[model samples]
Target: MTTPLNCIIVDDEAGAHLVLDHYLKSFSSLTLSASFYNAIEAMEYIHSHPVDLIFLDINMPGVSGMDMLEAMPDPPLVVLTTAYSEYALQSYRYQVVDYLVKPIDLPRFTAAIHKVFRRYRPLTPAQQEGNTAAPPPSSLMLKVDGEVIRVQLDSIMHIQSWGNYVKVYTEQQVYLSPVTTTEIEQKLDKLGFKRIHKSYIISLQHIQKITHGEVHLNSGVILPVGNTYRRDLMEYFR
Candidate 1:
């Protein structure tokens, strides 16, 4: 029995909800736990109930989706939906799983759900008493097929974005995980991993050389630093 992800739709627009609801039905691993036309109603429900994911809109009636998200002391995994592409960078700053523009397509929405499902989840009741679901890693988790296995933070050398999937290069092995670069960036940003390119995120500690807009890792791998990210990368290195 696979654990289903409990998710809720928090968009005021009925049409948005309708589209999302239809797309969500295709995944057996997801459960539409609830739906709210306003943030206030969603707020009340979230306080008492634990949900794994949220499909939030940028603009809502009064409180606004961003407002509620900012107010929440600890918000759930969020996938921001909006009609504006200009807010994409700002949305990622909020550590959202993915930001989807309005009139969400099935392929993109499915990718977002895969991000949430591939994310590390809490232990089952059986695991609390030691049923051997595998002990938690010091910092990172790797998704292998349907299971999310554990990996230490230091073992990660670099990560490459492969369309809807990411390849995690660790000290011992390279793992192919079903998640996006943005999702991996959010997960590893604070852990000393930095996104040097749109397609590459590298471990700062593993850098053997960083010059000519390229980073060489101790593992004998070289990754290109994106022009848009070079300034930030330089700032981090300094």
Candidate 2:
């Protein structure tokens, strides 16, 4: 079995720690090594400890979270948390794994962690030595409500935007994931998925019928085609 990812949280606010703690508890793949109310203290702790990830807050006292990252010559993966949107551009310069706004929801929190997991998945010794017997992945694992759900690619018929979350529709049931339509759109695009509207993405393989302004899936799901996407669909048919 692979080792669990160890991570630390550095934030000045107690409430911030509470929120992160609550979310991290649900992840079986991760374990919280330690948490610090000050970034400086956390920096010192990391020097003598092995941490795979870091959850940091931007607006701290001395030795701000960003400053802490600068101090490390090779900082582990980091995810920035703040109430403001202005630091997003600069956070990229720090090479953070993801950024979360304050009062983080379960879905978005899970998504951010999943991003880190996907990017830094540990390769076994055999795989590291150029093993090629394993087949490519045909499904995705989405963490929903503290449990990881494995979703098959071809089983997805469409996705609908539900407020701040998305409802993924397959033949079995609708699985909700915390993300924007465009986020999932990018993931499924290369896998025979196409954006049909601003709020919907449909799997091309599941589409059974199409009209000028709408498309019907084999599951009897009809979705309206957005004006912006109409031209693309026409060209695709041509």
Candidate 3:
């Protein structure tokens, strides 16, 4: 049998805790290790325990989720939780496994967890050394309106979520489709699209300038840089 993914929840809200608890119980592959109301308590728990994953909340009273991530000596795979869509782009810079908006539903939540398992599961020594056989390529075709648009993996710039739909921004134009941000994020994640804010995903190549808390695209679109994402972006610069 596959090992159950050890997980924890770190959020200040009581509702969030109860909701996450309910969702976690529904997943057979997941095992809850602990839950904390603040980052400090979570940090203490993690220091003395082993965890495979973390469901982290972005906005907190003190020592925000982003700050806690930055201070970790060795961080586990992270899935950011936030109500605001603006923090989506920033979370990608930290190499977070996924991002989930407020009031997360079961279907969306399960998909995010699956993505983490697909990407980070341990590989054998041979596989790690690239001696094992390669996996098949994963591709996604986007349909904009009635036109079938084949977006080659190399051409996508980023994806943004607006209400119930997602706007996939590319070098040429944007493709609006009826999909959740989390759903689109999983599809484009393997191709290098990083969630940098709650509503924006950026192509790392199209980034012209990153200053203050904004990412200036070559197309002149300025995207906000979240406080949590700033450090990771700086590391990429180095």
Q: What is the C-alpha lDDT of each candidate?
A: 0.82, 0.82, 0.78
lDDT by residue for model 2 over 63-113, one digit each (tens)? Answer: 677777765667888999988888899988988999999989999999998
RMSD of 3: 16.4
TM-score of 3: 0.51
Inter-residue clash pairs, candidate 2: none
Give lDDT tens digits, candidate 1, residues 147-190.
44567888889999998999998899889988789977876756
Q: Assess every candidate by TM-score.
A: 0.52, 0.52, 0.51
Which 10-residue window in model 1 sums to the lowest lDDT?
Answer: 134-143
Worst 10 residues of 2 by lDDT: 140-149
